[model samples]
Target: MSMPIESMLLAVSLNFLVFSVSFDDMIGQSFASLVPTMAAVESAIGLAIFVITFRVRGTIVVESINCIQG
Candidate 1:
């Protein structure tokens, strides 16, 4: 399934934020130093995925829609 570009970017940004915060808490590292490096890597990966998704076609269809009907 193809995701919307805006949704993909938002998801990537949120994921980065959550992971960075969790890593900081777990590792007891300095946020200032860690954030930049983490952000750079996350952004690079997100951009690559965005480009690839943009080029790809077709939305993914699940066989079951019952779960979404609530």
Candidate 2:
């Protein structure tokens, strides 16, 4: 049985969240001045995943042909 897309996405998001939180603390110890920079990096990665998900049709194919038509 296959998991729904929403479930998969939620799982991935949570995984990233955990990773980011851990990294945030580690980064905090070193360059405390770059918290904003770390946040922007996380945001950019999340946005990229969102875009790629929307681009997927049935199996993970990027709808390049549809993109050109639209």
Candidate 3:
């Protein structure tokens, strides 16, 4: 049996959300304030790439990949 991509992505995203909180806190304590600004810029660049990919394929991941079952 295979699971839907939506559920898998949701699980990963949830886990990452928790991890990111701790990771960001560590960065805040270890580095100067400007370090977090760089991470924010990178996140924005990633968001742009996601938007471009969605515009091109109408999906976040390749449709062909979703055709494959686990």
* Candidate lDDT (C-alpha), each: 0.54, 0.54, 0.57
Candidate 2 minimal-lDDT segment of 10 residues:
27-36
TM-scores of the models, in the order given:
0.34, 0.37, 0.43
46: Cα error in model 1, Å = 1.1
lDDT of 3 by residue, 40-69 (tens): 676677789678767766778666446645
- Deviation of model 3 at 48, angstroms: 0.6
Among the numbered candidates, top lDDT falls to: 3
List clash counts for every candidate, in order.
Answer: 1, 0, 0
Residue 35, candidate 2: alpha-carbon lDDT: 44
Each model's RMSD to truth, in Å?
A: 10.7, 10.7, 10.2
Q: Report how far off residue 32 is in candidate 1 (Å).
A: 3.5
Better of 2 and 3 by lDDT: 3
Give the higher-lDDT candidate: 1 or 3: 3
User: Candidate 2: lDDT of 27?
Assistant: 41
For model 2, state the Cα shift of residue 7 in Å. Answer: 24
Model 1 Cα lDDT, one tens digit per residue, 37-69: 655677688778656554553332344323334
Per-residue C-alpha lDDT of model 2 across residues 1-70, encoded as one tens digit per residue: 1235445545655565666678765543334334446556766776776676666643444454346443
